[model samples]
Target: MITTTGLTKVYQSRDREVTALDGVDLHVREGEVYGVIGQSGAGKSSLIRCVNLLERPTSGTVTVAGQDLTALAGRGRRAGAELRRARTRIGMVFQHFNLLDSRTVLDNVELPLEILGVSGQARTRKAKELLDLVGLAEKAKSYPGQLSGGQKQRVGIARALAGDPQVLLSDEATSALDPETTRSILQLLRDLNQQLGLTVLLITHEMDVVKTVCDSAALMQRGRIVESGTVGELLATPGSELAHELFPVGGTASGPDRTVVDVTFHGESASRPVISQLSRTYNIDISILGAAMDTVGGKQIGRMRIELPGRFEENVVPIGFLREQGLQAEVVDGDPAPKTPAGAPAATAGPAGTTAVPEQTAPPVKEAAK
Candidate 1:
């Protein structure tokens, strides 16, 4: 639904030139939720803003729903008529709620339709329906200042949909709220993506948000996308930095001789008991370090760090067995080690209900599929 080629954004100061985006190319498929993630200086904000021409790019092209937004936009900072009209079909939600404090919730939502010369009665009816959709119909008369942060964000979502947009751009829409509120907002976006068939392109610093909602994700660093792909593909790639970040399991290891391996499970492999089968087949005890399991878009995606009672050579057969079963098993610990302590369970739950592994970081890689 959205594509960018050589998308670069450069900012000029009196004595310096800074590039926020560097020859970036991205593709977000239709009817899917695509997440852009990075640290604060990673150019994540610039990329999303460029998508809708909110921050006009210094170079490159943006195509959405077959329309070239860059071509339709004016050469200057101000958007042209065609670009303005095109934007109506592309809605945006901000990190801050960006609501009009003076206007009531219903009035705030009606503003977008009003700009299109929609009649008062028609816009009012449409606004109410949107408010109901976001579960805020009863608060239509309340002003922005009177609502909680989550409620205000709901108002923002309702307003963004007032234009009946086909694409929704979320700029850290839940960053300001608490964890519980953040989950609520993310779930709402997921629901809207399914109900309206809206193609969502959101940028966030939080991996949890992406883990919970995005069908695919891109990782940005130093103004370039280092990784981009479906979540499953990322999980399946060994030493994927994005995958590691998404399901972190950092801690001190309890044993040095134990052979540790990180395994990724997705698709059919996620349903199988590969870990247990490995232990039974090899007759070697397995120790769980850390794990993260999530059901995204109704698919089970999981990453686990496990330890076997031997060196890499001794466990090669079991790892190969796991690979033949469609699991990505990479040995993280290779040194030979003593057997598990007496009476220790084969595995224990770690953070996020997955076994934990000590921190072993790596640089993010671009999606091979891209």
Candidate 2:
């Protein structure tokens, strides 16, 4: 539904030129949620603004629903009409609630329709329906100052949809709220996306937000997309920095008798009992250090750390077996020895010495598919 080719945006200060975007190419398929994540000054906000020509790009082209936005540079009434029509199809929700204190909840929701010239009866019906959809039907008469943060944001969502837009752009919408509120808003967004068939372009710095709702996410660094894919694929690529940020590994206290390794599971392989098999096949005592198992996009996947025996040398064979089964296993630098223990210390060493591994992080590599 949305496509950008070599999209570039630059800003000129009094003394210097700042390139907010540098020849970035991106495509978002219809009816899918695409997530863009990056550190500060990564052009995430600039990209979202450029999608609707809110911030005109320095060069390149943007096409949405087959309309060339860059070419709509007309003047007077004609340009205004064309841009209005385009914007009506593209909705945006800001991080700040952006509601008027003087307006009631229903009034805030109805403002967009008022701007599009939607009349009295039609606007009232649509506004009530949207408020109901967002579960704020009773708040229609209340002003923005009276509502909670989540409620105010719901009003924003309802207002964005007042035009019945095909594409919805979210700009760090949950950055201001607490964790519980953030989860609630994320669930609301997922529900709306599925129910309305709206294509969403969500921009956020939080990895949990992406993990909770996005089908595919791209990591932006310094005005460019460094990595992009399904979350599972990214996680399985050994030491993917994007995946690491999404699901971080806990610390592993190294001992004299154990080794640490990081393992990734995805697709059909993610469902198998490979961890148990490692011990059963090699007769190596394996102790699970730390593991995180979750279903992303309804698919089961896992990232785990297992400890091997300190005497475990020559991991080429066991690691090879994991690869043969279509799993990603990386031997990290650590010893599973207990604190101040030689042989059979209070640490117990868990199982066999063949595997003593803690789950500390490893260098990131692009995970290969199952």
Candidate 3:
């Protein structure tokens, strides 16, 4: 469990001060893979470091395992024996697999135990078990210089688990590896989260990485959490900046005469016969422009971009029918409605750079019940 209230980090030079984090708040439940995602300089790394007090916050409070991090901000170097004991349960893995070139794989894994004052026989046994756990049992005798990128990271993971941490911090752990290797490492992290019940904080810039492993994710911009929710929930959010970043729907626009609507469906409605209903009820020719399907937290989910023939004015009935089916539909293109809905502005341009027909304003809604 980790909680941060208005967590902030500021850095200073002679000329000026820059705020990396500004009143950020985070709440991670036990045994969940909570992800923090953003582009470079979004304060993602700074937030992760502040978790275990690796980076001292300029303001705000951080509480982990009941220890107040803000109270110990300036005392990181002198966090004392009790603080050190607490930190032993929080393991951190870096982007660069920080393995000593001179040390053997087994020795690298043994480093954390050594720092913890773990003795000879028990340390060796624990180190060997961890190496085996990471699928590098034979690599124990090999030095860090001999392993590939993936092997090196496996060693780093093994070392992080040396203290049997209750929480694991992965700071762009797969950024240095290729796609295939990244998949394997993420799979390993997911497996460990489930099997060992270890709470994991996965920080990355790649939406695919978060999509592959994170159950819930937060989008950070300007050191603040702009969006936070389950991956499916975020994906279903209409006009959400985070959703667009995760699933970029930009592509060639349809002919000027056509009408485009981005239909988002999740849960029971995802597999329902809504697409057919549109054709049967309205009897309009429809063409699917693009579609993507994925499982979020082991639930089947799918979203499709569909286009209707003729003009937006003629497609009004079909769009309303989709809404009744528990789907989110937006008029992505074509002429504005004859009249704008009360309190709703005229539609703007969509990713395809085509005119988006304005719609009657509707409040946000949750996913359909199971």
lDDT comparing candidate 2 with the true structure? 0.80
Clashes of each: 7, 24, 0
Better of 1 and 3 by lDDT: 1
What are the runs in model 1 whose C-alpha is more than 4 Å off? 75-79, 251-258, 333-370
Question: Considering summed lDDT, which 10 consecutive residues are worst modelled in model 1?
Answer: 361-370
Quote each prediction's TM-score.
0.86, 0.84, 0.86
Q: In order, what lDDT does every prediction score?
A: 0.83, 0.80, 0.80
Q: Which residue pairs show collisions in model 3?
A: none
Candidate 2 least-lDDT 10 residues:
361-370
Which ranges in model 2 have alpha carbons more than 4 Å from their true place? 74-77, 250-259, 309-313, 333-370
Best by lDDT: 1
Estimate, for each residue in 1-370, the C-alpha lDDT of model 1 and write its tens digit.
8999999999997899999999999999999999999999999999999999999999999999999999987765555878998999999999998999999999999999989999999999999999999999999999999999999999999999999999999999999999999999999999999999999999999988988999999999999998899988887765678988987754334665556777888898999888897776666788788888888667888788877785544554566577777877655632333233344323333323233222222122122112
lDDT of 3 by residue, 1-370 (tens): 8899998899997899989999998988888898999989999999999888878788888888777856754564675555677788898999998899988999999988999899989999999999888899999999988999999999999999999999999999999999999999999999999989999998999987887899889999988998887777787666666666765564334777667777777778877888986775566678888877776666666667788886666565566667667776766644443334454456654444333444443222221111
lDDT of 3 at 369: 11
